[model samples]
Target: MNDTFTEADLAPDPQEKRDRLLAVADRVAALVAVLAGGVYIGGMIALGAGAAPIVFSMLPRSIAGDVMGAIFARFDAVALGAALAVLAAEVTRMVAARRRGRTILSRLRRSCTLFMAVCAAYVALSLSPRINDLHRQGVQRDDTPQGQVLEAVHKRAELFGKIGMGMAFGLVVLSVFTIQPRRAEDEEDDDEAAAPLPPGPRDD
Candidate 1:
């Protein structure tokens, strides 16, 4: 019995394995980015279209504002988390794309994801705190100066939320279109083409 290993057998296998792993990672990252963006968009819609009206209609204005304010504060945390997840997933996909020798990082996609993150962070860190402070100060009425200021700030927050949701939706769409996994056979074919042919049997 003879045991021998050729360079051809060992050299190509590691690179092929690496390509396959990166492809799988890319797909997972794309899926995660899309799902996270969807969650953020859905939460915003549910809060604005469903919860706000019902809560305000059922409870007194002041109490409704308080309840909704609390919910919004909690959801700000959720939005920030979703944004971070999307950004992380996008970064992973970019790395995989670079490794695969493809340009999967579209500028529009990056811009949209970044815009979403910025809007979420702005609302969560900057605007939400102001709104919460106003709520705590019992400024629910819309007629007085402080109440008017609260209303203005609340409107601004709503505007930012809408913008963030729009960006999130756009990011999801761009990700679906841009970030795709290469077929396994395609990677294998590429690897085979790049690899050196096995040494032909010598004839004397």
Candidate 2:
């Protein structure tokens, strides 16, 4: 008995498979980054758009502070988790890309993602605690000089949080664009390949 297999019958090349998997992973990272950005932007907007102030004014100040603080804590928790996931995914993609042949764009993207992740971590862990401490002290005795200083510090931290969040949002947008398939390049290649054959010499 004789057996024969054609090219289509053979398994895909291992390297080709690896390349496809890496591409899929990169796409997933891009998607996660975009979704995480949306979540973060929404939470930031809710906090910055006077939602806390409105709620505080409607209730006893103490109760308002506690509730708002709890809400912010929950937001921070979610933000931190999401940021970690994004960072891990981005790092994985960067390493994979470098193994192949790192481009300038890939390096820039990795740096941007790392900076965004660090910003998110700092905001959640360090800045949040400082803001909370300052707010608590200010609210306890805001008429006093110490309380006034506390209030100023809280405001400054809040400003920093806004700037950090804005940067993170921008970086996420850039990453999304960076990971998108180069459709224009692909189209150009196709057009070149499909160009009409030059007119053949007419038969005598």
User: In lDDT terms, which candidate is top?
Assistant: 1
**How close to the true structure is residue 43 of candidate 2, measured as C-alpha lDDT?**
77
TM-score quality measure for candidate 2:
0.73
* RMSD from true fold, candidate 2: 5.5
lDDT of 1: 0.86
lDDT of 2 at 86: 70
Full-model lDDT for every candidate: 0.86, 0.69
**How much is the lDDT of residue 150 in candidate 1?**
91
Q: Show model 1 residue runs off by greater than 4 Å.
A: 1-12, 99-105, 181-204
Per-residue alpha-carbon lDDT of model 1 for 1-204, expressed as tens digits?
Answer: 557876765554777778778878878988998999999999999999999999999999989988988998999899999999999987887887774435444767888999999999999998889988888888875789998899888889989999999999999998888866577777787898899677998676
Show model 2 residue runs off by greater than 4 Å.
1-5, 8-11, 60-62, 99-105, 134-143, 180-204
